[model samples]
Target chain A: MGNEAFLAIGIFVFTYGFIIAEKIHRTIVAMIGGALMILFGIVSQHTAIEHIDFNTLGLLIGMMIIVSITAETGLFNFIAILAAKIVKGRPLALLIVFSLITAIGSSFLDNVTTVLLMVPVTFSIARQLKVTPIPFLTSEILMSNIGGTATMIGDPPNIMIGSSVKSLSFMDFISNLAPIIMVIIVVTVLLLLFIYRRQLHTTAEARARITDLDPGSEIVNRRLLIKSLLVLFLTITGFFLHQTLGIETATVALFGAFLLLLLTGENYLERALSKVEWTTIFFFVGLFVLVSGLVETGVITRFAQSVIDLTGGQLLPASFLILWMSAFASAFIDNIPFVATMIPVIQDMGNMGVRNLEPLWWSLALGACLGGNGMLIGASANLIVAGLSGKEGYPITFMKYMKIGLPVMILSIAISSAYIYLRYLL
Target chain B: MEKLFYMVNNELITLTEHRNENDFEFLIHTKTNEAADRLRKLREFFDSDRVYTDILFYARKDHEYQVIVRRDVYVPFVVHLLQLQLLKSVEWRTV
Candidate 1:
C-alpha cells in the first residue's frame, strides 16, 4: 500500500466513524469524504462520477415518487384498517394478520413507509383493544425486514445487489429469496406468537368495536387510489420484465414515475418530487465514490483475500461468514453503506475464482435484511416504528427492542443458514 | 388568530410575537429579551391554559426557536408557513 492508499483509508475511517457516531449528518460526512478523495487524487472527478450507481439512485427516487403519490391515496391506511377488521380485535389474530399485511406490503413497497403507514393504525387498534402495542409493532418491524428480502425492489440493499450483477433480475430475486423469506417469516411469526401469547387476550367490547370499523372511510380519494394502484401494478410488471424487455430497472422505475406524474398532473409534480429522500440518494452517491476509492487502491482486494484465507478457500464457509458478518454489522450500522462496501469485496472474491457467486449474494441479502431486526436502530423501519410508538407513550428502548429482536434475528439467520446449506451446498 | 411564542431547552421561554394566522409571516424580535424573562412570560402564557400546545423544536437551530402549535397542527402549520416545505432535517419530537 502507498501513501495514497493510506490517505484514502484514513478518510474512509473518519467518514465511517462520524456516520456511526451520528454526531454529524452522514450525508455531509460522506460528501466531505468523497470530496477529499477527489482532492487527494485517489479517485479522479471523472472516475468518481463513473463510480456512482445511477441505476440505484434512479430506482430509489422513482419508487419514492410512486410511494409518495400512493401514500396520499390512503391505500396503506385502508389496508391496515382492513386487516384490523379481519381479526375483529382479537389481539393475537390481529398481530398475525397485521404482520402478514406489513410483510406483504413491504415485499412490494419500501419497508419504512409500510411500517409508517401501519404503525398508527396498529396503535389505534391497540388503544381500542386495551393492550400494549409493543408485540404487534415489533412483529410488524421484523416481518417488514423479512418480507423486504424477497425482491430487488423490496429493499435498498437488494436493489444495490441486483443492480451490481447483470444476471440477477427482479424475477430471480422473487423466485429465490421469496420462498426462503416466506418460510422464515412463518417461523418468526410463530416465535413471536409464543413469546407474546399471554398478552394476546382482549376484551369482547373491543372486539365488537374493531368489527364496527368501516375500512372504506380510510380511502381519502377513490379516483387517485385507483390510478396509483394501476400505475404501481404496471411498474411491478415492468420490474418482472426487467431482463425480457432489455430495460434497466432504473429505466423502468423512472418511466413509471413519469407516467404517474403525467396522469397525476404537473401541478402536483413538485410536491411528489419533493417527497423523494434526496439525502438518502446523495448518501448512496458519496458511499459509492468512497468505496470506489478503496477498490481502486486494492484495499478491498486485500480484504477479500483475507476473508478467503479465513474461510480456507471453501465456498460454504465463505458464504456463512459473509452472511453472519453482514447480519451482525448491519445490526448496528446503517446497512446501506455496509452493503455498499461489501458488494465490491464479494465481487473481488468472485474475481479470485469463487464459483457460484449467487449463494454469496443471497447470504449477504438475507443477513443484511434479517439482521436489521436485531435492534431498534438497525433499520429505518424499526426506528420509524419506535419513534411513532414512543410518541404515543410506549417507547421501545434499544434494550427493550433487542430483548426480543436479537434472539429472533439469530433464529432467522439460523434458518437462513440451513436453507443456504440445503439449497446451494451439498 | 395565530399565537406566537419562543421557547428553548424544552421550556417555553418568551412571548416576543403575537399575530393572527394571516400575520404568521411577520417576524418579531424575541432575541433581545433575557432568557429568564422569556421563561417567566411563557409560563404566564401557559398558566391560563387557553389552548392545547405542542412544542416543536427546530432540528438545526436546536436551541434557537420552538414553534408552539395548538393541538397536533404543527405539521400543516409549518408546511403552510414554509410554503415549499421540505422535511429534510427536521426531527419532530411531539412533546
Candidate 2:
C-alpha cells in the first residue's frame, strides 16, 4: 500500500470509530471525515461529488415528504383504531394487527417514522385495555425492520443496494424477498404471541371502550386524506412500473411528491420540505464521500479479494458468511454505514470472478435488515420506540428487549438461510 | 376541589371534580373540536406519550370533547389555557 492508501485507511478508521462510539453526532463526524478525505488529496473534490448517489438521496427526500403529509391526514390513527375494533379489542389480536400494520407501513415508508406513528396509538390502546405496551412496542420494532427488508425502497440497505446495482428493480425486490419476509413476519409474531400470551388479557368492559371509538372521526381532514391517498397509490404504482418504463425510482418519487404539493397548494410546500430529515440526508452525503476514499484507493478491492480467498472463491460459503456477519453487525451497530461500506466490497467481489453475485446481494440485504431485530440498539426504529416507551414510564431495557429480540433474530436469519439455499443456491 | 364553571371566548367551559381515594380527576368539557384540538396539541407538546400523562382527551358526540386532567397536571393545563387566550385569568384562593 502506498502513502495515500495508508492515509485513506487511517482517516476511514478514525471516522468509523467516532461513528460507532456515537459520542459526537454521526453527521458531523462524517462531514469532517469526508472533508479530510478531500483535504488530503485521497479523493478529488470532483471524484467525491461523483460518488454521492443522488438517487438514494432523492428517493429518501421524496418519500419523506409524502409520508409527512400523509401523517397529517390522521390516516394512520384511523387505521389503528379500525384494526383494534375489527379484532374486538382483544389484546392478543391487537398485538398481531399492530405488528402487521407496522410491518406493512415500514415496507413502504421509513421504519423510524412508521414506529413513531404507531407508538402513541399503541400506548392509547394498551392504556384502554389496562395491559402493558411492551409486547406491542417490541413486536412493532422487530416487524418494522423485517418489513423493510422486502423492498428496494423499504430499508436503507436495500435502497443502497438497488441504487448501486441497476438490475435489481422494485418488482425484483418484491418477488425475491417479499415471500420470505411474509414467512418471517408470521413466525416472529407467533413466537411473540406465545411469549406474551399470559399478559394480554383484559376486562370485558375495557374491550367495549375500544369498540365505542369511531374510526371515521379519526380522519382529521377528509379532503387531504383523499388527495394524499390518491398520490400515494399513484407513487406506488409508479415504483412498480418505473423499471419497465425505463425511468429511475427517484424520478418517480420526486414527481409524485411535487405533484402532491401542487395539488395541495403552496402552503404545504414549506411544511413538507421542513420535515424532510435534512440531517439524515446530509449524513448520507458525508458517508458517500468518506467511502469513496476507500474505493478510490483500491482498499475495498483488496479486501474483496481477501474475502474471496477466505471463502475459497465459492459463492455458497461467501453468501452464508455475508448473511451471518451482516445480521450480527447490524444488530449491534448502525446498519446504514455498514451497508454503505459493504456495497462496494460486494461490487468488487463481482469483478473478482464471483460468477453469481445475486445470492450475495440478497444475503446482505436479508442480514443487514433483519439483523436489526437482534438488540435494542440494533436499529433507529428500536431506539425510537424505546425512548417513547420509556417516557411513558414503560422502559424497554436492553436486556429486556434482547431476551426476546436475540432469539427472534436468530430464528429469522435461520429461515432466511434456508430460503436462500433452497431457492437460490441449491 | 369543587365544580367550577366559566365562560371564555363565548364558550362555556365546565370543570367537574371527581375525587378518588387518593387523587382527584378534573373533567374539563370544552364542547368544541377547535378547543379540543388546541388542548390536545398542548398536551402533546408537554407529554409526547399522549396517554400516560396527567391529561387525556376523549372525543364525544357532535364534535364535542372532554379533557381529563389529573391534579399534578392541573396547574400547567391552566397555564396553557391562559397562554392560548382561552382563559381570561386565574383567581387565587386559600382553600
Candidate 3:
C-alpha cells in the first residue's frame, strides 16, 4: 500500500473507533477525520467537497424539516391515539397495529423521524394500559427499519445507494424490495406477538380510558394539519415521478418543505429550520470525504478484488457474501457510511467484469437495513428510540434489545436471502 | 422549602421542587387538564433525542386533582415549557 493509503486507513480506523467508543460525538469525529485526510494530502479540499453527496444531505434535511412541521400538528399523536382506540387498548393488537403504522410510516418518511414521532405516543399508550412499553417500542423500531428498506426514500442508506447509482430509480427500489419487506414485517409482528403474548393483555378499565380519548382533539392545529398533509401528498407524488420529472429526490422534498412552510406562513420558518438535525447532516459531510479518500487511494478496488477472490469469481457466493457482510457490519456501524464506502467498492467489482450487479445492490440494501435491528446501536433509528425510551425511565439495555433484535434481524436476513435467491440467483 | 400556587380554570396548580439542578422531580397539583396529555405534548417534537416525561398518578379528592409529573427535557425545551407554562402557572416553588 502507498503512504496515502496507509494514512487514509489510519484516519478511517481512528475515526470509526472513536465513533464506536461512543465517547465523542460522531459528527465531531467524522469532521476531524475528514480534516486529517485533507491535512495529510490524502484528498484535497476540492476533492473532498466534491465527494460530499448533496443529494443525500439535501433529501435528509428537507424531509426532516417537513417532519418537524408535521409533528407540530399532532398528526402522529392523533394516529397513535386513534390506533389505541381502534384496538381497544389490547396490548397484542396495539403492538401489531403500531408496528404496521411504523413500517408504513417508515416506507415514505425517514425511519428515525417516524420513530421520534411514534415513541411518545407508544409511551402514552403503554402508560395508559399499565403495561411495559418495551415490547411495543422494540417492535416499532424493528418494523420501522424493515419498512425503510422497501423504498429508496425510506432509509438514509437507501438514499445513499439510490443517489450513488443513477440507473436505480425510486420505483426500482419499491419493486425489488417492497414484496420481501412485506413478508419480513408480517413475520416480525408475529414474532413480537408470540414473545409478548403473556404481557399483551389490558384490563377493561384501561380500554375504557383509551375509548374516552377523542383523537380529533389531538390535532392541535387543524389549519396547519391540512396544509402539511397537502404538501406531503404532493411530495410523495413527486417521489413517484422522480425520474419522469428529471428532478432529484432532494429537490422534490425541498420544494415540498418550502411550500408547506410558505402556505403555513413564515412563522414556522425558524423553528422548522432549527429542527433540522445538523449533527446528522455534518456527520454525512465528513463521512463522504473519508470514504472518498479510500476510493482515491484505490483501497476500495483492492477490497473488491479480495472479495471477488474469496468468492472465486462466482456470482451467488459473491452476492451472499456482500449481503451477509453488510448485515454483520451494519449491525455495529452506521450503515450510511458503510454503504457509502461499499457502493464505490461494489462498482469497482462490477468494473472488474462482474455481470448482474443488480442482485448485489439489493443484497447490500437488505442486509445493511435489516441488520440495523440486530442491536440497540445498529441503526440511527434504534439508537433514537432507545434514547427516548431510556429518558422515559424504560431504558432498553443492550442485552435486552439484542435478545429480541438479533433473532429478528437474523430471521429477516434469512428471508431476504431466500428472496434474493429466488428473484435473482435462480 | 416553599410552595407556590396559581389558579387557572378554577383549579389550583402548584409547583414544588428542590432547589437543586440535580433534582428534576417536581410535584404538580391541578384538576382542569390531564397530566399525561400536558406533559406529553410539551415534550413532543419530531426528532429530539433528549426529551422524556413521567406522569405518575392522578387522584381526585372531592373535585380536586393532584398529579406528580417529572420531565427530563432538553435545556432549550425547559424554557419553552416555562414560557407557555403549559400548566398555566408562572408560579413555582424552590423547596
Candidate 4:
C-alpha cells in the first residue's frame, strides 16, 4: 500500500474504533473521519460526494417522516391496545401478540420507531397486568431485528443493501427472506413464551380491565389516522411495484411522504421535517465518504481477494462465512456502518469471480440484521428499548439481555445457515 | 386533602386530591384540549429519565387526566404545576 492507502486505512480504523468505543458521538466521529480522508487527498471532494448513496438517505428520510406523522395519530397505541384486548389480556397470549405486532411493524417501519411506539404501551399493559415488561420488551427487540431482515425497507442494513444492489427489489426481499423470517419469528416467540410463562400470570380482575379498554379511544385523531393509513398502504404498494415500474425505492418513499404532507397541509410540514433523523442521515453521509477512501485505495478489493483465498473461491463457504461473521459482528457493533462497509466488499467479491453473489448478499443481510439480537448493545433498537424501560424503572441489564438474546441470535443464525445451504448451495 | 379550582389558559381546571397509603392521586378535569396539553407538558417533564420524579399519567375520557405522584415526586410535581402557571401560586397548598 502507498501513502494514500496507508492514510485511508489509518482514518478508517480510527473512525471504526471511535464508533465502537462510543465515548464520542458516532456521527461526529464519522464526519471527522470523512473530513480527514478528503483533507489527506485520499478521496476527492467530488468522489466522496459520489460515493454517498442518496437513495438510502432519501428512503430513510421519507420513512421517518411517514412514521413521525403516523405516530401522532396514536395508531401504534391503538393497535397495541387492540391486540391486548383481542387476546383477552392473557399475559402469555399478549406476549406473542405484542411480539408479532413489533415484528410486523419493524418489517415496514424502522425498529427504533416501532419500539418507541410500543414500549410505553407495553409498560402500561404490564403495569395493568401486574407483570414485569422485560419479556415483552426483549421479545420486541429480537423480533424487530428479525422481522426487519424480511423486507427491503425494514432495517437500515437492508435499506443499504437494497439501494446498492439494484437487482434486489422490495418484492425480491419479501420473497427471498420473509420465509425464513416467519419461521424465526415463530420459533423465537415460542422460546420467549416458554421462558416467561410463569411471570405472565395475572389476576382475573386485571384481565377484565384490559378487555374493558376501548381501543378506539386510543385513536386521537380520526382524520389524520385515515389519511396516514391510506398513504402508508399506497406507499407499501408502490414499493412492491417500484421495480416493475422502473422507479427507485427512494422515489416511491419520498413521493408517499410528500403526499401525506400535502394531504395534511403545511401545518405538518415543519413538524414532520423536524422529526426526520438528521443525525442518522448525516452519519450515513460521513460513513459513505469514509468507506469510499478504502474503495478508492483498492483496500476493499484486497479484502475481497483475501476472503476468496480463505474460502477457496467457493460460493458456499464464502456465503456461510459472511453470514456467520456478519451476525456476530453486528451483535457487538453498529450494523449500519458494518453493512455500509460490507456492501462494497461484497461488490468487489462479485468482480473477483464469485459467480452467484446473490447468496453472499443474502447472507450479509441475514447476519448483520439478525446479529443485532445477540446482545443488548447489538442494535440501536435494543438500546432504545432498554433506555426507555430503564427510565420506566425496569432496567434491562446487558448480562440479563444476553442470557436470552445471545441464544436466540445463535439459533436464528443457525437456521439461516441451514436455509442458505439447503435452498441455494444444495 | 382538598379540592381546588384554577383558571389555566382561560379554561377552568378542577383538581381533586385523593390520598393513598403510599402516594397521592390528583384527578384533573378540564373542558378543553389546551388544559390537557399543558398538563401533558407537565407529565412530560416528570416523565423524563433525568428527573428522579416518580409520576404516572393516565388519560381518561371526557377530558379527565389522572396523575399518580409518589411522595418523593410531590414537591417537584407541585413546583412544575406552579412553573407551568397551572397552580396560580404555591399558596394554594396553604389555602
lDDT of each: 0.80, 0.88, 0.82, 0.89
Model 4 chain A is weakest, by summed lDDT over 10 consecutive residues, at: A211-220
Clashing pairs in 4: none
Clashes in predicted model 4: 0
Candidate 4 residue-wise lDDT at A109: 97
What residue runs in model 2 are displaced by over 4 Å at the alpha carbon? B1-54, B60-66, B79-90
Q: Can you write out model 1's per-residue Cα lDDT over A227-336, one digit (the tens) per residue?
A: 89899999999999989999999998999999989998998799998988888888899999998899899889999999999998698999999899999998998999
List model 3 lDDT by residue over A39-117, tens digit each. Answer: 9999999999999999999899889988899988979888887887887778888899999999999998889889988
Alpha-carbon error at A293 in model 2, in Å? 0.8
> Local error of candidate 1 at A302, Å?
1.2
* All DockQ scores: 0.02, 0.33, 0.15, 0.19
Q: What tens-digit string does per-residue lDDT give for candidate 1 at B29-92? A: 2333354234323433432232222332111122233233434554445443323221112344
How would you encode candidate 4's per-residue C-alpha lDDT over A123-161 as one tens digit per residue?
A: 778866878988999999998999899999999999999
Models ranked on DockQ: 2, 4, 3, 1
TM-scores for every candidate against the unseen true structure: 0.82, 0.93, 0.86, 0.91
Instruction: Give the best candidate by TM-score.
Output: 2
List model 2 lDDT by residue over A171-252, tens digit each.
9899999999999999999999999999999999989978877677667778999999999999999999988999989998
Instruction: Return the lDDT, model 3, position A249.
Output: 90
Model 4: lDDT equals 0.89
TM-score of chain B of each: 0.24, 0.60, 0.37, 0.77
Docking class of 4: incorrect
Stretches of candidate 3 off by over 4 Å are B1-51, B56-95
